[model samples]
Target: MAAVRFADGDWAEDAEFAAYGAATPALRALDAETAHDVAVAALALGLGPRRRRRDGEALRVEALGTTFSNPIGLAAGFDKDARAFEALLRVGFGFVEIGSVTPKPQPGNPKPRAFRLREHGAVINRYGFNSQGHESARTRLARRRDAVAAEGDDATAEPRGVLGVNLGKNKLTPEDNAADDYVLGVENIGEFGDYIVVNISSPNTPGLRNLQGRKHLSGLLRKVLDARDKNPGTAKTPVLVKIAPDLTDAALRDIASVVKSEKVDGVIVSNTTIARPDAIKAHAHGDEAGGLSGKPLMEPSTKVLHDLYKLTGGKITLVGCGGIASGEDAYAKIRAGASLVQLYTAFAFEGPPLIPRIKRELEECLARDGFKSVQDAIGAAHRK
Candidate 1:
């Protein structure tokens, strides 16, 4: 097979496109709806640079009972249907979490639902968990896994990386029956995922974040754990809860206690934020109605990671998201107690090249900080 060739300056080009592409009048002739279709087409064609591989800087860490080749992961919402898994893995993610998939396919919110805030290097998306749904994802993943297994190579020969599935409640599913939706999602796709993330924090879903409350969280986790326990396998799959960054410290502590008592595998420190920082206040899309994610979210999400680390006393695993654009940002999350880190908006702005850039930067940061490995850097910032 011929090797894929990613365009030169693709990362910078993506940034430029987000900044000025729409202003070209001819391009602006295409509305947001058409623009998205074009972007998806470009991604499907693999339009970015080949990831830079660093053998000496490779990172190994164990979390949720699975070992990851590196600490960086492609956060959910990037490939909502698992469409880009092979390409994404090649781009240097140690793990890839696909979807906030609903039990059934849905068109999601109306057009113009995704807004780019170029000034802040952020995106505001109210996609309402739009997806091709669990069955499609499950079918694709099973095929991929089987193909990998049939290659008959050692673990290293296979992708040998983690795949996480993020599940969400369908729009029509009432909050009262949310657990049923989540359970169905797990039953369908859990077998394919190395781990599963229960995503109840997307601002696009009405009354979703309310599930973060102790009563609902405990009840939901209990059922999901029970399902995992009953699966016909020797190993138990880890279940993680993804939380919003807007939670107060008191709320975070309450959730941490529940996570501990319920034996939840980990917590993704944030989804996205409703709070807009002053730095990006002048941007054109500043008033967009959706969760904001990008550079502005770095400090806030890292703080949340640190607080959760302190609250859980390092017992619960944490996956940090929000504003992680480069290796320094990723290393900061590691030191703040993130066992793994993820990004979405950064990818949207920087393209596939950002993946290797971050890994390279992280290795340099770890060495500069006198840490022998990525794991050694975990919680270093909070310790200070």
Candidate 2:
């Protein structure tokens, strides 16, 4: 089979596209969950794509106390258990956030819970925070850290971009006790992440979204932040919240108020939507019970990001995620107020070639708008 070729030009590593192209057919033949597992396993073995080009200066972003060579990050849910993070970073993501990890291991929902909406460039997943637990993930990260320390370069080596640890509650955990799970995440695995995400918006988890309620969210953030403060290794780690896209205007306002009042470091807008659009409802398994992400998510999620940006007056850092399939889509998120952006479904569908293409297109968009850097473009739409 011929390798997939980029329309614009051949800038990405040829071997990367060749490997993905050869593997795509076989991967697609398997169930979505199994395919993802196979891909992650391949990546974990260091067989993933290698980015042959460096990010241009136009895409650089300085946020969360470090410099992201580019603003595109691999969102959580892709590497739920922390496996393959290093390989993913090497694939050209400016950062990689792994997990929605729980204090204990979970089997997640039953089989066949992940579906690909190919016609819509989307995915529906009810993975329900399937994780091998904090201990498993902690051990993986610890080994990597130890390896670096052994090299005597731990103190001086530039970070391999930013790594974020996303935390979630176990399905069996009651709503009232959810805070304990998150605090446990910080205490156990927080030191490994450059930032921490308290995920309260996954639709698959029963009653998990309820934590987004102002009353509950406020208490949760405070305890999580306190855990960060008390943990010597994580004292300065930035803590963020990931919310759902289906929130009401009032709910967004409440969340904004709570976030500002508590001085949370950032907000990822959003997780996935339970609301099915007409386009999605027409697809096979469109009615499947789970959170919806991908193309249909682009607009609404950015709208929520825009609303939250306005509500918070842009004080809190915001990560734009949902349906970013191209550089134009990513730029839209930045203008809507995301300091950085992430993508998962699109990457899964198109593979590694999409990464360089996005950065290339984003550079064109920035140049077209006369913006010198990603920071200058962020919230530019709001100003106008």
Candidate 3:
């Protein structure tokens, strides 16, 4: 068992966080996916860490018409079925995004699709949107809402964060008619989330990234936005799009154009990269067929975010993702124009302590740069 020492600002002070640290070695003994399953199960049982300290004003962010206590969020794919979002939110994520959920349940690709590149601090996953589908997630969301309602004061009873529902199509859905899947997602679980993400970027899903093309993207967003508008319950919910990191300059520009033209709420700067860096290629699973995420992606993904930020003229909210394992990385994303940031690969590797570490380090960065808050630092690089 790992000794849980109480350092002044370490996450170990939290019993739940310390429990995660103590379990790390054992969890690491299991296969990557199995460990993920166990972690999710544990979180669902309300075993995840809870915040004992309030976020400093420097970490607060106002975006997508809502106020986030902090600017860091857990990206989608961590809780794909929404089984543990409440617990996850309690774990100190400014927000928790669950699902890459399909309209119907899917077993996803064959097993052994998730790989850890420990030496490189990365993961390659081809989960292929394995999901329990819309209904399952909606049921959980409904239950959470009901619980909050039962408490009578949602402001105090609910967790302090946002919930983003990431929507994806079933594998069998054809490319041309993909909008139907996203529209259904909005009509079904849209009202349950603070925001919705149209996840057209997961490389594991066949031809899904093709939707990023300008021609297809405009039509898709139009339909999805229409559904959002028509849904009485979710009419005011913000909708963001998740895009891949592997895009040419022209493609990036085209996506920026589409996003602005369609009036999309925001864009998650990237999902994951399909490229295998030479440094990681020698790893057994480095050449695996899937989206690559973690440290290796920081440079290219941030470059994409910078480009997109310039392309959009900083008009739309951008959620920076991919390769964020430290405060400096998150700060870079923020300076490049991300109003908010998220992570999964790093969290998978470091477990619960990472959340506070990053946030604390981020606050340090903000202070070092002489910025008062995350908002002041956003797009700061562009000013230079």
lDDT of each: 0.80, 0.90, 0.91
Model 2 lDDT tens row, 86-194: 8888878999999989999999999889999998999999988889999999999999889767777564544577899999999998999999999999999999999
TM-score for candidate 2, residues paired by index: 0.95
Prediction RMSDs, each to the true structure:
4.3, 3.5, 2.9
- How does model 3 score by TM-score? 0.95
Candidate 1 ranges with C-alpha deviation above 4 Å: 1-58, 155-159, 233-235
Candidate 3 lDDT at 348 equals: 91
Worst ten-residue run, lDDT, model 3?
A: 1-10
Task: By TM-score, rank the candidates, best first.
Answer: 3, 2, 1
The whole-model C-alpha lDDT of candidate 3 against the native structure comes to: 0.91
Candidate 2 colliding pairs: none
What is the lDDT ranking, best to worst?
A: 3, 2, 1
Return the clash pairs for model 3, or none: none
Per-residue lDDT for 1-384 in model 3, tens only? 122334444344566576776777688899999999999988887776666677889999999999999999999999999998887787789999999999999999999999999999999999999999998888899999998777675555434689999999999999999999999999999999999999999999899999999879999999999999999988999999999999999999999999999999999978989999898888989899999999998999899999999999999999999899999999999999999999999999988888888999999999998999999999999997
Clash count list over all predictions: 1, 0, 0
